[model samples]
Target: MTQSASPPNRALLELPQVQRERLSHIDFKLYFLGELRRTDVADRFGTGPAAATRDIAQYKELAPENLVLDNTDKIYRPTANFVPLFDHAPQRVLTALSRGFGEGIGEELKPMVRCEFPMALSEPKMSILAPITRAIHRNKAVRVSYTSIESGRSEREIVPIALVNNGIRWHVRAYDRRRKGFRDFVFTRMENPVLLEDSPITDEEKVDQDVQWNRIIELELVPHPAHPRPEVVMMDYGMPDGVLSVKVRAANAGYMLRRSAIDCSPDHSLSGPEYALWLKDPLALYGANNAQLAPGYRNPRDDSENKPIKAL
Candidate 1:
């Protein structure tokens, strides 16, 4: 028989939620950024110097081997045997790094760093998103009223496997019961999402069964032939050999291509300043369903049939 895993530190779990959150913040910075200070904790949590000090001391007491104080810099750095107190997800960590941390604590807490980026025009409604996310977490299906431009409004059941943000918008990758296939449902278009806790999902509805999502496609991108100063393009992409190779899920290849403004025509036909990179071989995307989203791509079979007939 397989051995069961050990439980979390009982004393750590017994601390107040606020203190636990502060400890998690300390662990997050130490593990990722390699150092922490009392002021860092105070600024992030809006706590006094004494409270921050107490929290750090508390964390050290709970995990004695996790950190060591550098007397010269007065900073706490991770020790050789450092272990994280929290399970930080990669997506959450990346978002915090890009946008600044403590977003969920409250709107009053200012970002730790000065940063700016183009604002997303829209977001999914929490009312609809909450239950869908709950279903995803609990491994259950959800019934939803969804609308699509191509098919209009309809009622459907879906087993949500993952959520995807395709540069412009957020969508859920799920097994659509009505269509009997895996489909991307834009989160904003969903309404009245009700988790089907009693409805058991089958093997077919699981993420493993999604072929396009499981398959990986390699894309070889190079500077566009018509681009002025191709060397600058190469340098911008850090491609010393004049090629940037990207591996993406076949389901998301077209989105990645479109988001990067890559020219995907077989002849490098698209011309514009924005088209810095061109797909070295458009055939690499032949089997991708979303390949139509790529700029200037025409199926080879369609091109062959369009050729004008010549006299023998």
Candidate 2:
């Protein structure tokens, strides 16, 4: 539901695609960046002042409560009652925030803003990605030539339920027929993907069957016990109570922990410079198939009683 949502300004749907896209851009700038100038719209769309004014006027007509014009600053600031007229994906917004926009738009056009962060290390080929994504959208299976670290290259049919970005790379969370279970297939390693339109997914292959993906677990992270300045770590992570709690799917818990360099060891044994936080309850990761991916993670049951840990 978060991936896509109905636009509040249903009237905007009646407009042509080109105009609607421009209006959406305006709405994005206002909602995310707090202020948007008329020239910002003009520069992004390569339009003149007159055309930009007309677009703004149309947006004002559509959602008068959304923005307020500041004559002194010549910027449109978001009003308190502002509700997004367009649904913006979190991934797209984060990309724009971190890398700036102007993605394939043009070199002449300026980026949304200056941004600095680690860029994507890999991207999947569109030829293979398209059909796989189409399969997910259509609720069907896909035939793919996949290469895995453990098994090497193999041809397989998979029922893809969702696409996951584990921070560093992309994955298709699918039901692997050969394995008789759900697994995450790296996108870049998949080749020659073909959508099997005739293959109707059975109840067993649906997302409901994937316990790790459906189950949510809350992780409690605190400053590394050995850290010299625990207060600084708390401030940095906005942990007023010296604890940062996050709820994530069991399928993604390991990736989240690894991505943030949180020490997942029960004893807080990780001494690396990258580790700023430690998982307060290593037992919280019980039943998480991907927990092995977490740095220094050890199953608490490996040394003690193997009882089911209560879900948070």
Candidate 3:
């Protein structure tokens, strides 16, 4: 979260308060210049139009020679003489320089990890974004050519209604005209997209408001004393000692399990005879691993033929 410095309440904190007030005034002035109309300026500052008008007049009085009236729009604008006072290009340049230096250090420390995923910029891909944004804004239907992994062929005339990002990829949430229901289309798999002139689909059952399809997995791994701790993995929520556990929300449980294999070092031990894999919610699996088992505790997988009992 980004936060601005708070203003002080007493004389002892006068310096900081004055600095905050000055910064706030500069921000408001820039906003007024960019937005033009006094109504827009007043709306931004949460002040009445009369107060905004008075402030504009006072600003012009202080810098009489630095204000210019826009005849076309019947609005006042700041001249070149006043531009230097509000210009933020120097601050932006400093911010870019700082970010570049920090990214360089991060790249050196983690050579194998890429900061962001690569997205291919093809003409069809670029063209889809505009219509998708428009469809989202207008709440209309869009026709698109999409490829399906199961079908192994490109299908045309799919109606898309929403756009979604699943961290690693982008997808379009749409009502399939052929299937007569909602489906998700991967952006990379879309070949061609065209806006449809037909009326938007209005079936309530087909619209999905909650698009996130993720399940949380809590895994408890006991590391061996000999093996060093995993360095690259993020342990946002964990308990250290011999036991290490994490709550990972994932769209694909198998993919997450495969990725977590790297974090479980060779020296770690299992906690139970048949690792205690408990599914908190039947719809999703949530489980734990153990180094040793309690005597006479039956393996959870023994009764279920489909369940795979294996080491982390």
Candidate 4:
């Protein structure tokens, strides 16, 4: 759950979707990102060379123009006039690299220079998300024992709509049948989701009416004024003209702000090591557009007696 840990795109492809993800990943990193090694294929799918070889051949058979074998390197290189068969998303590529390094897929960690990354304190199990995914795809309702800072642990019936990444944590946007309102449920907080056989989506539970989830809001960020070297800070953020405009869904703005540690306080002095960036316009995050979610900025659980779902 490195914020980017999504279940592999399996269902959209043809039959034998079990291996669709492995095949797609091999081709994706090969043609779009870099060369694909059989070691990559083996490590990714936890399969031996024989199976990995078959997957590679299957991918080539489907999209023969994409990858060329480099015998000397024993790797598949992206070919000229290569076109991707499976769709690629930039975030997915970055996350795969992060997870690969974390799992030491192709490299031994001890030999590489170690760098600090914000470790995930809580990551929801894939077992929990799979049922939620099935429920959403089928537009069905589910039952789960959810532990929230607001309601604490309770059994509830929910019509799951979408699985969302609020930059740092994964959340499910669902219409609570009990509450009769939409709420964002942290994936980690859920337990034993049971997809109901007969539950159906109600008109009140439609995602289209969830304005905050759909509305996009832009926030301009600049290096904190307290930073001694603004020029260096500018280079760090790659800000052009001393400003970086970030467009994110209103519902997810709080997460980006909290993730970046951008101070939105009125007296927004840098608080700690995390607060290197500050919001240029505090109101953009706190004003009307993002009001419902952004007010509970950093410490969301503390203020959630009146809000739906705590801060990611």
Best by TM-score: 2
lDDT of 4 at 143: 96
Order candidates by lDDT, high to low.
Answer: 2, 1, 4, 3
lDDT of 3 by residue, 208-246 (tens): 532233335665544323333432112422433434555
Task: State each model's C-alpha RMSD to the native.
Answer: 9.0, 6.7, 14.6, 8.5
* Clashes within 3 Å, all models in order: 0, 0, 6, 0
lDDT of 4 by residue, 219-258 (tens): 8878877877878878988886898888987766766676
As for candidate 4, its clashing pairs are none
Q: Can you rank all candidates by TM-score, best first?
A: 2, 1, 4, 3
Clashing pairs in 2: none
Error of 2 at 169 (Å): 1.3
* Cα shift from native, residue 16, model 4 (Å): 19
Per-candidate Cα lDDT values, in order, are 0.84, 0.85, 0.46, 0.71
lDDT of 1 by residue, 104-156 (tens): 44565454445566799979998988898898899899999998877789999
lDDT of 2: 0.85
Largest lDDT belongs to which candidate? Answer: 2
RMSD of 1: 9.0
| Segments of candidate 4 deviating more than 4 angstroms | 1-90, 100-118, 287-312
Runs off by more than 4 Å, candidate 2: 1-39, 42-94, 98-110, 303-312
